[model samples]
Target: MMTFIESVQQALQYDFILKALLVGSLIAVSASVLGLFLVLKKYSMIGDGLAHVSFATVAIALWMSASPLLVSIPIVILASFFILKLSEKASMHGDAAISLVSSFSIAMAVLIASMARGFNVDLMSYLFGSILVISNFDVVISAVLSLVVIVTVIFFYHDLFAVTYDEEYAQAVGMNTKFYNYLLAVLTSITIALGIRIVGTMLISSLIVFPTVTALQVSRGFRTTILIATLISVICVILGVLFSFAYNLPTGAVIVLMNAIAFGLAFLAKLLRR
Candidate 1:
């Protein structure tokens, strides 16, 4: 139904769409792999909480006139540290603490954004995502960060796998699981910041959790799960981008929805087989 000239015009007018697709697919791939461990560890909600922290940091960055990345780095790093410390207290459940922090962070973001004028419009894009508005700088930063996330995950794969399979044994074997946990939190924070411009605070976590979750429901092996999740995420991103382009819809939301659909279909398939 589409002609070559129409396709070319669409591509030219939406160059940012290509940029968003590239960055999002890369993000989806890495996040899907990383998310397998997070889901296995029962810390999937941490990704959602970290996104809220990023929202608050973005507000602070606007207030201070500093680069959002620089400002978000310390804030999220500290938040991650505190989360780790709280998890150790033995009195508070990790999920409860994560929920409290996520709520508080989002409230603070709203209050801060309301207090500051002229940032609300720009802020909306970050909240809901403007994939078509991704900048050259954002593309470069995302590419480099994706590389870092991928390399770190690969280098630590064995240790992470051991820890996930059995934290008790990992501790008995002298693997400082505490350190790896903190490291993962830091990595997640960085990924959240890197993802804001592409998927925004609200929807970024779908990229992190959905693909891995879906893959986990189907694949028996961890490596296979990661590979399948990455593939699924790429397809979701591509479809989401095209759907957005045709419908003039929000790209991140469309992508996330596609992911949800994939999850539903996978779940249905599993149920039918059973």
Candidate 2:
């Protein structure tokens, strides 16, 4: 058997692996940052909901022979808006709105898949991830979208934090709560889309939720939590990718499992500290 170092070198020789690493790292940072706010505001399920919407959009795009990324992004963003609208006007709040949309979207995706190709390997890739099939175009799209997420979060950090912690207080203080809420939804949609390639529709939300909660176990301040979560996410992505490559395992599942391990460690550490 090849040594660990040799195995890593062999994996790095593949272009797809390089793209997966770069894109996965970017997605990790974006997801972890956005997740902090989502977790704080009890909107973590939005990522999962949007991921399912993207699933349907991807199926539709495939049925029409269109680019899945291009087709899914806008549709997913619109779905995010719809969820927000439902929450605001229909008395469906948080997880209820998410579950309603997600359940419907996933059902639509299943129907489309059945009518089109009956759940082929390509569709499996989107559902469970296919990092090794990542193309240059995928990398470029991931980079651009990830950059947008990072910059937007930084630009609106204060407003997002205020709204996340206390929406009514923020509104009372002249903050545009609605705008920021929509903004968060939009950014989250983009992040979820970017992550679909790396972690698949089924597991993308783990990237958004796990690291933040893990970091929260050990972090005391907001900025510190963000920093720690980002670091944890990046580390998990890198290590998980490497481990998956070395063992010929599924990248998304490995990354999520690593995140779970990190969470366990953090939880234990927190218990010890107390």
TM-score of each: 0.93, 0.97
lDDT of 2 by residue, 144-204 (tens): 9999999999999998999988999999989989999999999999988878888899999
Candidate No. with top TM-score: 2
Q: Which runs in model 2 stand beyond 4 Å of their true positions? A: none
CA lDDT, every model vs. true structure: 0.83, 0.92
Q: How close is candidate 1 to the true structure, as a TM-score?
A: 0.93
By how many angstroms RMSD does model 1 differ from the true structure?
Answer: 2.1
Estimate, for each residue in 52-160, the C-alpha lDDT of model 1 and write its tens digit.
Answer: 9989998989888877767886788788777778788846778887887889999999899889978888888889878777778778878888888889999999988
By lDDT, the best candidate is: 2
Tell me, what's the RMSD of every candidate? 2.1, 1.2
